[model samples]
Target: MTDARRASGKNHYLWGDHCDGWRLIDGPDLSLREERIPPGCAETPHVHHVARQIFYVLAGELTIQLPGRTVVAAAGEAVEIAPGQPHLVRNVGNQDLRLLLVSSPDTAGDRHAAEPPGLP
Candidate 1:
């Protein structure tokens, strides 16, 4: 994850809003993606082929909506998603939502993400 205090460093993407830090922790076991999503921004709906995902809310609350149910996860809470399950996330707060998302099956890079119908 990019240091919040790092003033003169480059970040992951061009939101100018959310700060992100990504690293390959294990050689072939898992990966970590740290993100800070500004209010009103949301991640597109996607799926994994052979891996499971765990989303942990570090600071702010996040609204996670799967195909069947929608749940609000507060800070220090976590949610697990099994393989082939389609899911998506949204930041429904006024503050930046800091989150840690981990994915498995990193060795084979078996990821299958699809954009939602309304999204480009």
Candidate 2:
């Protein structure tokens, strides 16, 4: 049986600087989550060894810093990150940034912190 899940009523966790995340689906092969990032907050740069991820923005703006460029996704937009890609997520807007993070093959135990590209 499948049940409805909402961030407000799901398993919530905090990350980064005052960020919030709720796991909507946590299966062994796939993971889905709703994440909220306060303004001016950013997650540490990291890479997934095998899992590919997609960030779909639900509200505000999402800025993803990649190796040589930065991608910005506003409401109704999404960014796709390939496996082994080192990227950093940031909330550069004034309001709260809300997005759905989807990972295939799951990311648990596969994340490795990495230095942002272009940094000496």
Candidate 3:
């Protein structure tokens, strides 16, 4: 049997400067989450060894910083981060940023934090 999921009814946890995340789908092969990032805050740069992820913006704007450039994903836009690519997500707009993050093969223990921007 399949059960419908709703963000309002899902459990949320705090992450990174009061940001919130709700796990919409949890499984071994795939994971889906809805996240909220407050203005001026950012996630740390990191990479997944085996999981590839796509981040879809639902509200406000998201700044995805990569190796050589930064990608601005406005509402209704999405960006993908391939495995082993170091990246970070930030809320550069003056409002909260809402987005859906989908990970294939689940991140699990595959996250590796990289040095922050402009650092060696």
Candidate 4:
């Protein structure tokens, strides 16, 4: 029998200054994680060589900076980031941002740090 997983009960890790990540499902072909970012925190811009990812908001707000566009996703909204697209994820709201990150073909060993154009 397969056991159910929850962020509070799963494998936990920290990343990107006060951010929390819980591994919900981890596999070679696909992976899912529950991530939380405190207000005003952001992750470094990066690109995946072969993994495509989706960020689905569970609560609060998400601000994503892409090549030339910015995407804001609230509760129940989602945004997809294709492979090779440079992007950064941030929490621009006063409250903490919570979201589910899903990646296809997994992202391990496939992520490359990038400097997005135009902004420092």
The Cα local distance difference test for each model comes to 0.70, 0.90, 0.86, 0.89
Query: Tens-digit lDDT track for model 3 on 1-117?
Result: 112244346466778897888888989899999888999999888889899999999999999888878889899999999998888889989998989999998998989998654
Tens digits of lDDT, candidate 4, 84-103: 88999999899999899999
Can you write out model 1's per-residue Cα lDDT over 1-120, one digit (the tens) per residue? 235453234434333335454442544678676667778878767777788878899988888777757878989999988887777778889888888878785614565576552421
Give the clashing residue pairs of candidate 4, or none.
none
> Taking the tens digit of each residue's C-alpha lDDT, what string does model 2 give over 1-120?
122344346488878898988888999899999898999999999999899999999999999999988899999998999999999999989999999999998898999999985522
Candidates in order, TM-scores: namely: 0.75, 0.90, 0.88, 0.90
Backbone clashes under 3 angstroms, per model: 0, 0, 0, 0
- Candidate 2 error regions (>4 Å): 1-10
Off by over 4 Å in 3: 1-10, 117-120
TM-score of 3: 0.88
Give the winner by TM-score: 2
Better of 2 and 3 by TM-score: 2
Output the lDDT of residue 87, model 4: 93
